[model samples]
Target: MDEFAALTERNRQLSKAMMQSVFELACDLSGLGPFPEQAAKARGTAPVNARLMQIQQLIEQLRADLQGLRGPYLMQQLQGLGVDQHSRALQLHIGSGPYVLDGWINLDVFPAQLSTNVLWGLPFVDGQCRYVFLSHLLEHLFYPTDAMALLQDIHRILEPGGVVRIVVPDIAQCIAAYQDGDTGFFRDRVEHWGAGDGQATRLEHFLAYAGAGPDPAWLFEAHKFGYDQETLIRALQRAGFKTILPSTYMASTHSALRVDEHSQIASAKHGDRHYSLFIEAIKE
Candidate 1:
């Protein structure tokens, strides 16, 4: 284990060096001055560049494989390929990750199972998915106009009666949890769950500020905006999704819709915080 740890540390340093060298080359290509420290610092800032995030995710997967841990994104990719442990039928999965949720195809811009543009190119989209799962994904898009247009494209891609399962952090829920007394507790929860680390706890409030770092608050700086339940419902309606009642939705719940234990670990019991939400909208 100690040898493994030593090797991991050594590899991390090597990876950083390789990444820095690449960045330096990019700067040279663009006629910029040396900024190795700045480049390294940029690597950690919020609103992580999509391309950089993809690279980081790939590295993390490689590290996981080296450490004999499950490669986080591999399951999603396998699920996209219909080789998942459960052997479930796969569909379209935009921005795949930790959850290789059943029925998602694991699409990204960098071309794994599928590739799309900033708005998920509608042209290459296979109009066959029963459900389009965007778990913790949409928050990274920068332009709402482009995003709405993409949503429209998504609307076009779904078969009749298909559903777009959208999961995102409920910003209003966080605000309410923070303001209705017990500010400190909710703040801590927001920091812990929102940023996925301890540093964000200190800058939680800055999330509301424009141009703040992505690592500071919210899931990503690319999280250009957020929504409350009402706004999200309204957005779905505008995008041609029939708003599903929680009871009815839960009643007809597909096997894929079951929330996992990890997803629920820090729910209301964990300091009255509001972290995430899943909404299903059927094309009517």
Candidate 2:
């Protein structure tokens, strides 16, 4: 396992042990006796309950402390910006991968000055943002529930007429190409799959690229779920977006909400223009 995986495992084990210890302490203090029918009949139960509440409060405070520790530097940067600056910002780019725009606050999980964990929830106030953009990000989340929650959170942070533009790999197109026996599709994208020569079959290359490989990078970038137009629209609708529509690259109903030209140029060069699906949803 990589260092990140090992560290995450260790943290999980520690959290489990700590929770168990806290539960045991609470049980011991509460006693093995059955509950009394009346509060007046109970002897010293009030003290036990009070102690348990105190312990629970301490645990909650510890949780807050841990959250602070997870992203102290990011938090400092955000705080320095102040609430007014964040609220006044018109656009946000979630998981922005090198496609920086002039007016948008670009955020990512990796090494960026504005790095943020979106699952922890956005820092902006409700109905504060005018636009949010995400490109090739939803599939990286390991669960549909998590993706839905993120969408709902995005919806919460957007203005009533705000829009969220999303771009993701088109699974329908991939499957269609595969079924049509398009060997070139697999062979051409082999570099994205992994470091292997011409030895591996096209099927193997396709599988590796689709995230069934042994590479740690594949594990990190693997698509948990692929989406076509319909499924993606359903997800957005479920998140309370009233208006959802399919969009083409670099084009949108709203001029201000168009996809970045750099992203369009990159997509065209990468030969995934037809392999990607773009969708925009309005918060109305």
Best by lDDT: 2
- Give candidate 1 regions above 4 Å deviation: 1-90, 109-111, 118-120, 123-127, 181-203, 206-221, 246-252, 259-274
RMSD from true fold, candidate 2: 9.8
**Each prediction's Cα RMSD?**
10.7, 9.8
Per-model TM-score versus the true fold = 0.54, 0.68
lDDT of 2 by residue, 1-284 (tens): 99997897787667666756766665764675545324524663555566668978998899898687766666676765454534653688888777877667788875444766777777677888889988888877755687999999999989888999998777666676678877666554544434466677646644543435333323444666778898899999899998998998777888776765556422532355455788999998
lDDT of 1 by residue, 109-228 (tens): 543455444353443333455666665566566545756776777777777767776766667665665566555655556545464444443336535422244432222334666656
Residue 138 deviation, candidate 2, in Å? 0.7
Off by over 4 Å in 2: 1-66, 70-72, 80-86, 191-218, 264-273
In lDDT terms, how accurate is model 2? 0.71
lDDT of 1: 0.55
